[model samples]
Target: MLKISEDKRDTIIAKLKQDIDAANAYYEETIEPAVMERYAIFHADKDYYRKMFPRLSKRCEITSTDVQDTIESTMPVLMKTFFGSTDVVTIQGADGTDEDSDRAEKMQELINYELQQNKFFMKFYRWAKDALITNLGIIKVDWDREYKEVQKTITMDAEAYAQYRPQAEAMGIKVNAAETNPAGGINVTYTAQELAKNRPRVMNLMASEFRFSLDATRLEDADFVAHRKIVSIDYLRMQGESGMYQNVEEVAQKAVAPHYTTLDTQNNEYIDEQPNRTDTGRQKVELYECYVNLNMSDDPDGRLTPMIVTVSNGVILRCEENTYERNPFFVLSPRVEPHHIWPETGFTDLIAQVQHSKTAIIRQMIYNIAQGNDSKMAIDTAALVDINDVLNNAQFIRVKGNVSEALQPLPAAQLQSWTFNMLEYLDTVKENRTGITKYNQGLDSNSLNKTATGISIITQQSNQRLELIARIFAETGLTELFRFLIKLNQLFINEELVIRLTNGPMKIDPSDLDGSFDLIVNAGMGAGAKQTNLQNLQMVRELSTQLAEVGLSGPQQWYNLAKRIIEEVGFKNVDDFLIDPSQMAAQMPQQGEQETAGEDSKTTIRSAITDAPWQVQMQFWQKLGFDVTPQMFTEQVAQKVLSSAADAQAKADASRGDVMHDRLQQANLARPRGGGRMAGTTSNAGAQAGGSTGALEPASQYNGTMAGNAAGSTTAGVSSY
Candidate 1:
């Protein structure tokens, strides 16, 4: 433990108290007065001071009295009060503390420093206010309420007090001696922490109106700047090159020939032109050329200049120079009218003219035929010539008169062969026509009829025997005849020859070559038969086995065959064919011996009818008879046998007192009634007969008796089993 003597402790405590008191007094007397001065200045300027003093004195409620109290409340107010305002200040203390004397001396020093600081702040505030008023038009003394609040926040501390003590003493103010205290003396530190925690209101009061002065000026002289002028080459060269030309003769020689002139040079020369008219035709032309030059710059070699040249007739022509002595230049040749090398004529017009001329009379003949006219005679005459020459240059066949000789008329024989060959090709066209129409138009009964009729007509026409006017006219004879019909159809029926011929319907049956008939007969019934009848006819011919055979042959054989068959077959009435008892009896065998034979045959038949019911066989048998009902004869007999046998067994079992057997037999005979139970009464007699009360014996006993009866029947009689 550390201890101090009572005297030393007392001295230390007294020194600390004195120092605190001095610090407080300094702030009250010095720092507070200086801040008040600034506050007064800030309050005077309203507009210019608002940014710094955001709040006015009225809003902040700051006053000189409030400021003084604030300073007195804070111990460090002394340091901020005096030294805070001046550039520098010093505080003086007594060497030794003799209680009253030391305290009085220190207090005097602090008071002196405080007074000096007050004077310093007053001077600073006055100077600042004057500066702002002079330069920025601001009256610092009239600042608003916020400025007054700022004035209240000024504070000071021990170091500041000590620093200003010497000046304070010189100003007749007291300072305090430095000392330490056993209990911590009044704190004189102004740390940001203490300011933030304990003096926020005061600090905010000052901050709200805090301001500083700024000075600015613009430089008069700047380094980067310029001014100048540009000269023109045209202006410099306006005096002409003569003054600058040393070798005039050489330049003149060079100018004697044409030289190329660029657009810019030409424009310049054009701009420098003068107008004049007192000149020869050549001179006048030169003036015109000069006029052109005045509107354009001269070419480098004067290539665009038009010169006047006189001809023998005194005609003047403008020509561009072609010399290249000075510099190469482009010269355009004189314009001339173009002459036609050949005339134009249309092929159609030429052909028309040829058709009208007598020398080409054949052309007209061909044109008439091509237009679907009846030109058979002319075609016949042309067809007699060489085929290549006739066809290639054929008068009756050429569509256009201008057709070349290579397509002349074909010879009659060759033409006949070609026509025949074309018929073969027409077959393909016929096939294609059917296929195309079938695909596009769809197959229907009507279309099929039309097709068959068309095919028949075409086939007949193709195979027809024609009477030729002459052998040499065969080509024209056939073609002209066919063409006439085609043209007639085209004119009257409005159908094309190619379509009428090639698009003819498909042949229904190629084998029936002689079945040609008019399609319009019987309202087109013949057309329907063109397909169906031909098909039937074909079947009769090709499939003879399938037909009724007849030995007749050649033309009309079918008709004869039909007649003979009809005559041989006598007519019979329906009743004559009907089954009678006599016929039925004849169909059956005689009784007795016949019956034996029938029985033998029945055995074989029965074997064949195995697994078939008697009723089924009897139905078939009665079908052979005219008046028998299988139901009355067969089904009734079967029902009677079944009923009688069932009844007899029932009576026998009852009489035997075999109640179990009786019940069993009843069960066997009884059909199912309802609810899945057999329709038979339980025999109470069985219980009475000393049998098991609730049960019946098996059917084996009855089965044995029936078997025994069946064996006895076989031995007793020979009847149909």
Candidate 2:
């Protein structure tokens, strides 16, 4: 139990309230309005934005859902474009550790594995994409072990030990002070001189160690935020201010600190709002879990002070300096603000004007329907008992003569036409503001102004806007989350673990890894187009094959290029679709050919040796009747055999390249062709030089025939795939 003085208690509570008051002030004024607006839009609650409706008309569902529809329709599209297409997270070592690049890549794989196993990554993306207007994202670490079980000890020296009396035969470290040595250690003592002389010799110590264990865990946001939080530009700063402790090292390894659960019990500040529960306007705070980090401290290093304190409300429940092992939680402050530069507002802010216009149109349409036409009406004000009843119902009232013509059911054509025009105008405003439109959303555009060039420009703009938001989430939320993962792994990983990273298998010890990694997120194409990547890959592949025939690149280079294309296409494991070079080498027929060539060369050499007089010849003399010596015969046979093998392999590769290039070209041919689109231009440079000589064309567009393609052949025939 902590011994807290009353005065200190009052001070801490007062300071907490002061901070809360400041946060609340910001929340009530700046954050609340935008947050509330976003909330209403999400819930489709017409009443929330009903105040902004036209004064002459009541709020209508059709007008209120305008903003909601725009937001909802755009959310899935943005998510599909970003997360749907981009399925890779690449972590590369930027601090010049390419020697261990594979290790870092494996760590990335491990993270992805760990992420999918526990983290709400996709779920969070789905939730955060639309809501990105207010906050970029809320990333939390769901680790295998948020905290470890640790034993702590309390040790007292000889003087304190001798003076201590045993209250219990055996005991824990926690007991009342009145009980002498309540930790229950037997007192041991000796004369000062005798102790000094023999203490080392006897290996006897008077010091007593009282040990106890505690459960440590990471903190949730509720552990710290007792009052409402303001998630503005200052929110992270406010969180930084909340950290307070005694002497525990700020980045301490094993120092004793209070676990969030312990602090929560002491403070009793938790109010659980079930996250999965369906409700509107629920207050949810994230990134405010300071106590989780406070739970971690350096390993009781003598340099830093240890703390054991708990509180309830503003009052201190307990504050002690008892020795204990602390939890190991580390969180990084986000490097980028998630609010995406619009700190004062969000997605709803951009839609507010359009929403008002939509509401006015809806209200006018309502009036048009109520009045039965778009013409002037002159009904005597006193002719009806109730004007509202006359408009809404078929209630008849004593009117000045016949009131039927006065209530003209004017032309429906004008009413319907104008309402639709207003709707179209409002939709255009929404499309411009949000960068979401019928074209992008897969809805056909009815506007006469849409052209291929114009639609193309709008498509690019929409993609860029979504790309910006996705990147904001990536840079701030995902990056910070990765930092936290690296920190935690560094602190807690004890041994190497083998993980089959998406590319290949690798072994990694997270603790051994440095945290200087550059995160490369393949956010994929913001436009739902995969052709550009495929086309570029095909071109590169062709270039690589051509380079190999010219001896510029080795076989390994082409193999690597192929692997890259497979991965770029979003294949998790490339070996499935692509052949492994090692496997191909193992299956190759080069071994048998070398063996056969060696035997033939040996036969020729033996024949040359035996051809000379029934004796082992020291040297072969190539003169008179024998044109070749034994060595010459061997060289000739070896060169001929190896050349055959090399020539065969080259021909096989050339044929394969020709087939693949043709297939790719055909895929292009299958698509609707247009100018400025990447086109395959034929170059006979390689073909004419090395065309169809049963060897790879080193410079031809068609990688066939080192002797040049057959004269007058057009493009390589496309396979009817």
Candidate 3:
């Protein structure tokens, strides 16, 4: 750390303070008003309605949920699209060497593992939701090192203690107590100082807590950016002890000086509805972690270098040059407008006007209906005995004078059909604006009456809108987040990392990830598009099989197709379904042996097919694109059938059924009774008829016997039929 003179330090702090105050002022004056309005729309705040339509206390004040509905529905789609698989992020090696590929795989695993450890799903949910509601969502990623201590008590001999003390003390462990035991060994109690491992930290900052230069379009181009947080005084002291800060006593003293809570600013006051903290005897202070480019006038080049400074209550806590060489914040917006830091429109923004119009219309409609149902009467008070009698729903009311003259009912205005028609029109307008509709949401009543082709087209167009948002997020913020994490891991996490994935454990060394790697985002398209892709892949799979017979496609092509299909279907363990082509090729016999074995294999295969059940044989031939029967099983057809089956079997293994009986018993216990009968179960009528039901024919496949009880419920157990 460079030791700075008091005057120079003051000059730097003043410059940062000036920049932060100006940025905050600009945000409070301009951006926050719109953000607050959007939040009110999202929550459907009654005050927001009151502000819109003033002094309508007794009238209908119902607010529409258009904003909430749009945001909520879109969030699940975006989340599932990004995180549908284990490999949310992938890296491709630049050189394409085996070593580089392996390193890239390990690096990708390490990045994903770090994200999992940080509970990134929930963080992303919040971040994306914020971006949808407000125009921008921000996240900070940095390498954090904090102390972790554990206390341990152990019994050991004096010689063992002597051997351990030096090593333990070198690691900063403190010996609390040591005493001789009755059995001639020492019982020692000590607080062990664990290794200070550097790990990546991800924090989702509210739009209010972050500030940047007003003219900057991106974080990297900004001259100043700061994150404001209210931290405890003790946290500052800890930083001093960790040698991360200078002038601890002065900084703590300055922080203790009374100041407004960091979140109490006008920009952040309505950011969230949270209770004020009661006195907890721990002093709290506002801390600004600012990243800025400071020009040291003494330098001859006069270039501005990126630096990080921590300040609180006009006191500098820590200052150092930025070693990471880039900004740590990643921003997300559903749509990016040209020449703007935040998008001009958000999901809620698009629907805000619709919600307002709908709410007003609904309130008017209900008010009109209410008035019509309880009509006001023009009663002659002088002729009526009591006014309260008219208000009550009484069968007959006594009037002092003629009944017809004293109590004439006032005619209420009848609501026109256009009132309801207008509401529907507004809903249609909303659907058009947001690309969310009752049809796509599966809520339209008339959707079933429409042709399947029409419905599919509508769904496809709607999905295209959502897919654009997903792609924008994937190509921008998500990519930046992974890139930032990769750089952090390379810089701070020098040692090997051992992470356990779903498949198995992997050991990754960050140093091995030295070469360039391109990021591969695994964002999924919408469900309809995915289904289309799956269909295409299936068609390709069939084509690959056919080509395999002619030597155009082989086991490698088949394995690749199977791998893609399995991944698209959301399966991670490809090995469970398909054998690797390399392994299968290695297992093949030599040319001489294969020639002899081919004849023997064909004879055995034909015998097996002949003995198989007629249903199985028919289905097998049909799957091969052949409509065949027992009469069609000639020698010429058998040769073609055997050749196709051999190729298919070589590429992939058919999965065997693995069921646990204990789990089945548990499921049976949980299953409710007195419902539909299980498959292969005989009914009471069949039991009384005294013959096997056709349902029992399939029991031969599982080698199970079904016996009917007195209650006519069949019990299935494993036995030869």
Candidate 4:
């Protein structure tokens, strides 16, 4: 049984209760409103049915009057007698008590039964009557005797009555009374299904029936007014003597300048002084190179003012008075200066060249070729070619011309010198490039170093070598030179066949072509023996046939030989022979087994106690003494030895157990034991000896004895309880 601490148990209980409470609270607060809303919608539907049923019954009654005049006259009487005569009729039977009251329960029951039977038709009838009276200006049946006598005295017109009957019905009223006043009363009857069909139309009419009046005048009389007193104050104050007005006047005075001047009469001072003619109103107007000075103050009343003028194209006019004073004020035309010249020139050419070089380099990078002959130009071209070669293949390079044509105009000697100098320059600049003090700061030194230097050198060398080779080719026009070398290589490799197809007719021997075909097919089949060589052979044969049709005889001959090999030798022998070349070389003799001579030499040692009977059983304690007796080894000593041996064996066995057992035990705590069989002994002598031993002592006995010893030792240990 397991016992838990009170604190832990209490904590678990508290947490469980907290979760339960939270669940309960969530259900109550969030779920209740949705349930209430659904209930409200259901009740609203029931209310609509209860309130609309009477209006539906009134509309139906008016529709029934179309077929019979008596129906039109009797409808009112029937409503008064069967339903009720009240404005808002409480439908009832003939009982004098209120039809809904319990005292008139039978009458209420009768009314309800009648309502179920004819309520829809009755409502439609009522709606038709009201519609006819309102829209067609047709009269409903007069309940008063005066209207009934007049209707009875008028001669009934059948055609007029028939034509207007439907219109009258559509308008929810009856016009059939004057035409159908037969001695027997007009008859009208309908089933529930028929009434239901018409019920919607009746209900729609009732729904649309409305009363309107001129209420706008009444609304106006209730709230309209002719005059209203505004309580707004003036934002701008008049400039009177008051302080508020004075403040406004001061503000206005500051806002606008005075246009007139006044004189001070008390001191006889000219309040508005006439300004000096030359100083106050002097105007020097410069019209191009001319200056016109007008003194407006000379005419005190501002009439025509005298003006002084001077004109000069490029000279200054100085008016020197009789006083002999130098006047600085003189009109002088500014001299035009020649256009300024830029200090430096030819930068544009240098810029354009640099741009052209950069553009060329970029274009070469994309096209995978070197172009141009200048030093920087050649360097850029080489760099670009190197970059492109690193990114793509040499075959993609655009320059197809031989090396000599490619290098024709280059200054080879000068470029070689410059390349060596550039190498030296790179070596010298490397330290500066990487950084003189591990902090790179020199731009010019860094510019000379690049990771692509090796590629650049290789590209330059390749171009030069190609150019040299092209020069040789161009000068000698030796078209067969490369082909001759290839042919020699092929001959040395023992591949002599040359299959060619020409526009002219040529005959090919099938056997010769099949042999070449076999060579190629066998080469591939040799490496992949597991593949179906026959399928590959068949495919090659078909492709070769197709190629032959297209005049590609070389490939056809190769494939044909492959097909012959596949058909003749079969895939097994052909694949084996191709794959293992030694199989085709020579057959070696099978080796026979050689007898191993046993060693006759042996080592012998003298017995320590020859005369004493040998005790092989007691060999474990042989080092103790030869005189030791079996009985001298007591159970305790035996048990102790067994325990020690068992303990040591257990420790050793733990290390020696099956690795799988250790893994299973490590992975699972409940691993079952004794589930695997021990390995069988391989030695015949050991097997026979083990059989003769009558199954060795059970391991349980040794374990029990060891456990007993362990128990005894445990008993002697210091006890805490």
Name the top lDDT candidate: 3
Worst 10 residues of 4 by lDDT: 136-145
lDDT assessment of candidate 2: 0.46
Q: Candidate 2: worst 10 consecutive residues by lDDT?
A: 198-207
The CA lDDT of each predicted structure is 0.29, 0.46, 0.73, 0.27
Backbone Cα, N, C clashes tallied per candidate: 81, 27, 0, 32
Maximum-TM-score candidate? 3
lDDT of 3 by residue, 1-721 (tens): 6677888888888898899889878787777777878888999999889989874535977889998998888887778777774354578888899888988888887888888889999999988998888878889988877657888899999999999889888877798899999999999999976556668999999877788888887777898988877777677777788888777677656655334433345445643343234532256677888889998667657899899988888888788888878778888888798778876677787888889889888888888898899888888888888777877857667799798789987898999999889989988888888777776678988989999878878888877778887788878898888887777877787677689887779887767767788888664556346666788898998888889899999778878888888877887778788888776666766755886677456546544654566567557656645434453233224333443554454344323223444444344444432223332222334322322221112524322333343243233211111
Score residue 243 of candidate 4 by CA lDDT.
Answer: 22
Query: Candidate 3, which ten residues in sequence have the lowest lDDT sum?
Result: 712-721
Runs with alpha carbons beyond 4 Å of true place in candidate 4: 1-448, 452-677, 680-721
Candidate 2 C-alpha lDDT tens digits along 1-721: 4434566556545654554445445445554455555656555455654665545435244555666676667667555554442443467787756556755766666666655555444555544643443432222332343323233334565456545534322332332233235566433431111111100000110001000111112222212222112122233233234443231222122222222222123224553324332422232322121121122233444253344333323333335452313322212111233422224456666777677677677777787675664455456566555666556656455565567743544354346777788788878887877777777776774644677656666566666665666565555545555655655565556666665555566777655465567777775555444545677789988888788788998766777777767755666466676776766787667887886687567556545543454223323332222222244233333433443554565566567788765665555334431222111112223222222111111223333531242353322211000
lDDT of model 4, residue 301? 62
lDDT, candidate 1, 562-680, per-residue tens = 33233223222222333334445656655556766765575555445423565675555445442223432343344335546667877877777887666858675564422332111
**Which rank order by TM-score, best down to worst?**
3, 2, 1, 4
**Candidate 3 — what's its lDDT?**
0.73
Which whole-number lDDT from 0 to 100 does residue 96 have in model 3?
95
**Across residues 1-721, which tens digit of lDDT does each residue of candidate 4 receive?**
1233445334433533343234334323432232222222222233322343344433221121111221233234223322221111222223343322332322222223333444534653453333222211011110011112111223335555556557657764534334245753333221111111110011222111111111112211211111101110122132133222223322322332111211112123442344444442221111111112122233446542212111111111121111101111111001111221111111111122222233333333333222223322122343243446423546654334354443234343322345445434443443322112111222344445655444334333323322332222222211121122222222222222222222222332222211110000012212112124455566877777787787886633663465355534433223323333343233322221111111111001112221123353235234433323343232223333433554465566577677754654454333221112111111224323332111222334434533554533321100000
**lDDT value for model 1:** 0.29
How many backbone collisions does model 3 have? Answer: 0
